[model samples]
Target: MVTLRIATFNLENFDEVPPNVRPSLAERVAVMRPQIERLQADVLCLQEVHGQERPGQPRALLALAELLAGTKQAAANVVTTSGPNGEVFDQRNLVLVTSLPVMARAQLLNTLVAAPMYQILTANPPAPQPMPILLERPILHVELDLQGVPLHVIVVHLKSKLPTNIPGQKVDDFTWRSADAVAEGAFISSMKRMSQAVEVRRLVDSILDQDPAGRIVVAGDFNATSDEVPLVAIRGDVEETGNGALAGRVLVPVENTIPEPARYSLFHHGKGQMLDHILVTRNMLAHYRGSEIHNEVLHDESGAFATDVKYPESDHAPVVATFEFA
Candidate 1:
């Protein structure tokens, strides 16, 4: 049997910004290189990667691959999809593999999904206005050959839960920001994430429709916790029949092996939260050996952010899952 390690990490906007403006590429690499080396993942899915806006310009992803040179976990093969152009900030999802051979690669972006009624009509308009549904980040899909075993991988970064309030719009008058403004904003954000999750599930279903026993892995910074609506939608609730047969194919979150208090990936205002996850289909779960959340790498000896003489590595932690193949 062959064991493969797959990991997902959010690089926290790895871009080549002007020096002193933000942490430069060199600074990020300085802190991230060692952490990635420790992961030693055969297949790595990355989010918040800054892609080059120009069509033909040099890509930071390639440069990151170069930085892994001479490391045990060097990504000799890498794949990435471009984001929308002419934006002040451009971010993308990327996949890097050291051994697995990619069989196919595709990306989902700007795809439309059904919008909730509340989003379409503030208070029942003459006609429901069309609301654009765009993915916060393109889902990076890659099919890899792990010693002849086809493994389907989908990398995603769901919409963040930030308040969506427009300027000059009174809190009481805004549809998304009324008496319960905070709750309303959260509902809107969750709706966006739920739409994205639905799309991911559709992609999973597409693969399953072709092969019921397909091995699939979906990993990334979901930005939502395990019990949240978004995750609930992606990892459908389990249902069983009298004969003990699963109702349908449902993804399962890899068990959190890390000790209780330390399982979190990010800390905000002293509250630690597990925003990153690695989930696998039932077929893949049969081969799942174990999983790990590399939260330790995000901190230093002093238990604070890993300061590399300049800046912190990343605000998020990396999650790794190991699976055995016969």
Candidate 2:
């Protein structure tokens, strides 16, 4: 019986910014030490990582590892994957582990992201931007050998659709119009998000259509609610399609992770929303029978995240699960 633990976190602004007006690298590392250590996860997934340079997220993984240096087995390595924040020269994906012998020999399983599905977000604007054009958001896939059997894992972050109504924004008043601008492509920025989510589903379907027996875990900030459209569409469970299979839910049945009063990754209309998520294919879901979102983050004892006490953890918590290799 081989047990593999999987977890995903939106490490709130976890980056090595300027390094001037910030906590020492050492302090930052210490803050995360408890979380990573508590997880004792064999494989970890992270998003919202920032760095100064090529797919280099803010060395948060390194910092956290450093904080847990002596304890982490001597066989761990960092695998960096590029994300959408390349232009911001910030936030990237970092995969860390205590041990995975197959890692040294495991090849990228299914990363044939179509070229046409290019990213739509650009950190740098032609007239007023300084970042790169959106590429597809990074999703890390690796097939690990657990007790001689191979298991696949995928980590991802989907497009966000929060801060819904911005003034001066060319959003159509859906109630007033036959269809809102978002549905009709009113704001290129907002529409791009919907496009990204669709692309993810397309890619996932393409992958599973080829390997229905494959195990896949799709997790990250979706920015859409369990009752939202894009997600409903992914599962084809929306009233319109009446046919999707994907299921999304907060690990704990009670105690909402998306708290009120500016909870979630960002604030919109003075309300909090959950953009972070974890999704599993029907096959994989069966194996990963149970999971939870560790919303208890310690980003700060005060400030935008002061309300957290009973649950002190990342603003965007870590969603994790343990599974039996079937």
- Highest lDDT: which candidate? 1
* lDDT values for all models: 0.71, 0.50
Q: What is the lDDT of residue 275 in candidate 2?
A: 58
Instruction: Say what the RMSD of model 1 is.
Output: 4.9
- lDDT tens readout by residue for model 1, 1-326: 78788998888767666556646677677778887887888888888776544466644454455457777656357777654552323455455555788899888754535545554233222234545544456677889887776889888889898744432334355344344555655566777777888888888878888988888888998998887777877876564223334435688888555677877877665677888988888777678888888776454323465453444477888888888778
What TM-score does prediction 1 earn?
Answer: 0.81
Models 1 onward score TM values of: 0.81, 0.63
| Position 324, candidate 1: lDDT | 77
Off by over 4 Å in 2: 17-20, 52-68, 71-74, 83-90, 94-98, 101-136, 146-150, 162-186, 237-272, 297-313
Model 2 TM-score?
0.63
Question: Could you give candidate 2's per-residue lDDT for residues 109-167 as a string of tens digits?
Answer: 12343233322222112124222224345555555656664445555565444323322
For candidate 1, the 10 contiguous residues with the lowest summed lDDT are 119-128
